[model samples]
Target: MTEMTRRDAPAAIRAIGHVSTLCGVVAAALIFVSVLITCQMIFLRAVLGQSTVWQTEAVIYMMIGATLLGLPYVQKLRGHVGVDLVPGLLPAGARKALALAVLSATIVMIGLMLFYGWEMFHLAWERNWRSETVWGVKLWIPYLAVPLGFALFALQLVADLWAVATGHDDADPNVAPEDRRH
Candidate 1:
């Protein structure tokens, strides 16, 4: 990508990435809070000889939410694990093509997830589903994250494909920085 195009990539795409980053930060915070709560639960159970009820269920839900909500941010940062040896050996044109192909496949998979996730969320909402646990938390609340996360991930993937096609993303999509020198 030309320096000019890099500077000129659509503001919308940049905005989406920024939102994804914010969501990721929130996910991290949720995980941190979950850990703290779990510790508290342990203390109450072991140290104080008190019964713990909601903590375990809450922690599990938070962790699941965190994982789902972090997807877009991970994609935005290119943090997902991938093998890059083949792309590294290929010429620039071939590399770009491969990147596009991989991104396209990712988009398709995420898109499908988004669709099915939404369906799941809707079903839970409509049926007033609740967990079987004593906490009995609404299932739709957590299910909501599934579609939302996949949708954001799909959007991020589209932005990445656009960046690659426009030369805004000059680095090989498949290769990590540390591995690039090899």
Candidate 2:
């Protein structure tokens, strides 16, 4: 890709990244809300002498949903844990090749997760599944996060791969300029 085209190539990907970041922010807010709810539940039970029923389960579900929904944002930011020793040691060409290989593998893994996650969500929805708890929330509601998050993560990976392969982005954004030399 030419410099100009390469620059423009990432516009779409950047838009998606922005959306993923928004999701991350929303996930953080959800966790915060869950924390507040838990505190309220505690105050109600301990201070006001009331029984708590839904707070615990609701918090658990919200936390799980936040985690699942945050996957794409994490991927977009390259926030996932990774050992870069091999890439760091390799020459530039080799590093680029290795990065492409790793990104391809990740795309495959996330694709599988997206596929199966959708199946699980569909099954739950079709069966009208509900939690066994007295709250009895629909199982598919929370399960939707799995497929949605995986799909977004996979897309982000694809975009990253495209950027790298097209020379629009550095394979290792974390590596300093001097360290990239042979």
Prediction RMSDs, each to the true structure: 3.1, 3.8
TM-score computed on alpha carbons, candidate 1: 0.90
Candidate 1 lDDT, tens digit per residue, 1-182? 23454467788767887988998998999999999999999999989999987899889889998998999898877789988799878877898899999999989998899999999999999999999988888999989989988888898889888888776664544434454322
Q: Which stretches of candidate 2 lie over 4 Å from their true place?
A: 1-9, 172-182
- Residue 133 of model 1 has an lDDT of 86
Candidate 2 steric clashes: 0
Cα lDDT listed for each candidate: 0.84, 0.82
Could you tell me which residue pairs clash in candidate 2?
A: none
Q: Estimate, for each residue in 1-182, the C-alpha lDDT of model 2 and write its tens digit.
A: 33344467658867776888888997999899999999999999889999888899889989988998888888766679998798878887788888899999999999999999999999999999999999898999989989988888887888889887776664554445454322
**Weakest lDDT window of 10 consecutive positions for candidate 2:** 173-182
Identify the candidate with maximal lDDT: 1
